[model samples]
Target: MSPSSSHSPSPLNPSTHPWRFTWETLAHIPTLRLYLFRSPTPTALSGASASASLQTDRSLLFVSLTYQSGDVVRLEVPVPRVLIEPDEEVQCVVRSDHVEIKLSLVLPVDHPVVIQYRAAMGFSGDENSVPISLNDDLKSLSSGDVNLYCKSCSTKLTKEPLRHILQMPSLNWRDVAENWFGNCCCSFGAAAEPGFSFEILSGPMYKSAVPNVDSCNCHDNAEGPEEVAHTSDMHDLNHTTSNCIVSNDPDRSNRQNLYFGGGFVHNDTNISKDVEWVEFCCEKCSSPLGSYPYWKDRGNTGTIDGGVRLFKCYISTSTPVGGSDDVFRNYTVQNLFSNLLLESAEDEVSFRTVVRDLKSRKPMLQLVLLSSKAWYMSGTCIENHATGPDCQVELQPVVKVLFSDCSNSSEADIRLVENWSTKCHAEEVYMMTYEIEELKNSLSFGKQSMPLSCNLLQGMHLSWLNSHGF
Candidate 1:
């Protein structure tokens, strides 16, 4: 085969050059780019009959770098079929000529929940940002369409919102529902009436029985009205407590008496049965004054106000009943109601925090009530103003109203006197009363009763029971 003296064509001809390439020439070629993609880890695939159905087919890849010479050559390569498994290492190798490239295929196991959450929220910008992918089965579970569990651990991973529906507090369900619907519909029905109302019964009568100036003793140094007016002009100042300033004044002691009345109404239907009794307490203090049977009068009233019409209506009997001594001493209506509102507002804040925490994937513990104090403070200011010196100077005290914390404690106590006269000027009035004995009989006899609690704030600890008709 000595072709130097022969007319044979060169084996390195252009047409055959591709078959004559050496290993070094092929080694300089660009590296093959391999891309492997698979569905999210099937922790558990719903509708699968058994664990064996969870397995997926192995993927294969091939790449041709160069045309081979007449001499047939075969390269041995090992590829990883599974990227993740228990007690297994992901190892593989690709062989070319005398060189072998070690490859490692590792599937990430700790996928973040935020990735799936964001995706579910309709994010589609970047894959690197989403570290986890939710399967259709899991998505269905979160959407209230189904329930799912993890196959390997048999753990329930998702549930329906209905499971938490019954957890609403008995006392709060009505208000909560009202607020919810208010936000949704932008209008309210008769249920939107204020929770409290009261009317005045009578009067501006003076303490004195006589209308003549001679009947009341004037101080020895006191001047007559004319003299006092002259003195005021000379002094260039007005004295607020001058007794000689009497003008034409009618006798108040001769006027007739007055009366007032009204009560609260609850619209919610769900109420718990475990509430044994309700303690009406002062709105300002936490003291317990008295206890009434739960739901005594689904619409009954209590005569806690003496002759006053202010009565304890909606009552809850199923509340855990303990000895008066066992009750918290300072539970006042004001404090309890304020606290209830505060806690609800706090929950809403915590919900927002939960949403933020989920986004950051960071655990949080401390939750603060942002609006509770503000509301209480505002209420205090208004109450103070209503009972301030200005009001005292304009109105005369008539009948006194004593407020007590219905609980066993002495912490909640309030005193208020009727000082303003009503526009009606009626002396006689009718007030309703819920007989305690009657309420007790109803509970003992298992008769239907109102689920409202007169003592506890309407929102704390009883909403769920109320909504579920406990």
Candidate 2:
């Protein structure tokens, strides 16, 4: 099908801005969504309207809109397959608001509709889908001793090469265990382990993977937390295990920290009481590197102590090369968080996430992933018209999300939080306050670039993050 009453062209003008564009292929039917934002003051572009057309081969699609003032907007985008030509086959819907135009495209079908739709929308098949995980540079340990330095100033933070590295489970490992094994701990032929329960805490709380203090002790003059088991046969555990870490020697404890998610953790004994946690900073630049808990909590396993968790984004690793250092590539906060959220979503089977401050455990941001496999094209109307005939639209991969800042949530948001908590539909992720602020700023900037009409969906604000290679 083609647009009705197609206009040839006049000198282009900036009457409308299609600030937000999305190409979707997840469903059996492929579709396109666009929002054209109009100015507050009606211009010669009054009575502005739009139309669409497709090339004969359907390799490219054209969109043109005309206003009462005779201004025109013309855009061309590439399609992966031929488009159905009959008017009835194509569905177009347009709605006008106080300051925007909403356009929805439902592509026509052919024999074996699903196949055609997916191909046309550029779904390259399952083999092209890349998996996201924790950053490999820090996740895996190389042969021999590895030294860690501050990414900003190259200030050495570790006294020696890390000897042994262990992986920590997710923050909600206990809940995951309970869900898989049920409330009864006898499933594995043993009672539930002490110092753990599936009950949700009453307010915001930071929970870490901590081992039993009494049983965990370092060997061979190494002051590190020892691995301990609650029972003999608890693989199919119904309760939680004390999977924590501890380190006493300040000189060598740095080599024994465990790596997990996006950070490294070290257990300490001299926790303070005035502040719940202390921010660990780089000695050279004073840049915040991580934090350790100061307050103590009583548990079934006795005084529960927290450990220092060092973020991977703020640090860099190096290996000795001919008595010199070979620094690894720098990482970003966005990439680190993206990997973490993507992995957690797949593991927890939920798209809704609550990012909290690791120290305070206060919810900082709430996000819902709408489409991990998405391509978006965003441009201003002025820029589109200014580009003239040779204008080329470049679609970039992005992870579309609906998000909201929880720093100042409303009653409705509170209710949403309660619902998520009660039903356990949202997974909690932790980061430093500064890192959370950085993520929030990135998302907010993306939202600002979009049209007012497309910046929000449902009650949450909409935004996108650059995909971690899909």
Candidate 3:
């Protein structure tokens, strides 16, 4: 049900028919509500296996509604089932356990064909406002989370807390015991968003220095994407040039030099063997973001845990505060890292995304990483001071940390979620259905909520990923 102006929406027994009295308060626009059974133990979103374990009749159902004028507003609604029907009337009535919530899209859709865009929070349209770089906005922030979304598809990737990420899980853990004890469950609670917050962490990334002659050869040797001429209405960031902010820069925050990272485990079990690095790409577009190394670093965290390398920079439309958004950057401890507290999964490989090896028609397995459940945006602001000629202060977004556990998923039965090209693109798809019969392993069965959805690489995501020139 929609929120009331007098008070927040309270839980009401749907059988009592009290919602009719509150129906007058909701907006006139059409709304879509998704319902999912919340089992006592959290499970992934794939249909069959997850459904088997759930106590359907008794499980609680959380509801999240999205009001789309033109574009799809991807709320953080994680449900085992999604039912979409046109609005006959502005009603979302359901049974008591089948809870329903309503939250409209943040912006008003004026354009005839408005595809949602994930602009930095501070970049709102106000003529008097001075624009700052995303990097500048992030650095001055005290403590908060950042929302990481696909730039091309605007798919709401995740919202995570900066404070919780800065506090624990210092390094990427790789043990099942650690996974069982230290867990982060991504239950949306009354917060109507669909995507998980910090359970499956993602951040803006850059290309790694390591050379991969096969796909992305981006490294120190790689030049940035060509200049992207943006519209005048784009996020104006001329005021945040390094020269301007450097003079007023407070805290001179130490750039984080290292943090935990993860990737799919391949052959070359021994660290001494040639390292097999797991290259990370944008799920939608397939653009190379960074790499998670397969070899554990004995010098840093014990040999089994610290091996993945993350390229943390993605040159955007505007130049960054202190530097031009030109070259790709390697991850520094300042950008990401926390106290060297216990609990990380650097060795355990739970989920897998398989692609085909064109040379031999063999299956190539890539493990996914569980970073931080941190999302920052939607509330960041820049207060321009009238006293000083160009004084500006950055406001931090609200920070929240949620967790997920994928500890029980063994044998990896999650192979059914195929890549975008495999399902959508018929001729371009290289891997036939019969190729990887032996490796059709199901995910480890566990009581965790980390790997909720399998990301597909297709459409705008694929186009943007393949576009190195952009």
**Candidate that would win on TM-score:** 2
Q: Candidate 1 or 3, higher lDDT?
A: 3
Answer with 2 or 3, whichever has the higher lDDT: 2
Off by over 4 Å in 1: 1-267, 271-327, 349-370, 373-470
lDDT of 3 by residue, 219-308 (tens): 121331111111111111111111100011121111111223332112212222322334445556654433433323322221222122
Kindly give the stretch of ten consecutive residues in candidate 3 with the minimal lDDT sum: 460-469
Q: How much lDDT does candidate 2 score?
A: 0.46
Model 2, span 401-467: residue lDDT tens:
8888887778687677757755866766666667778899988876764545556786678887765
C-alpha RMSD between model 2 and the true structure: 12.8
Q: Candidates' TM-scores?
A: 0.13, 0.53, 0.22
lDDT of 2 at 467: 54
- Writing each residue's lDDT as its tens digit, candidate 1 over 258-327 gives 1111221111121123212333332323322222222233422322111111121221111222212211
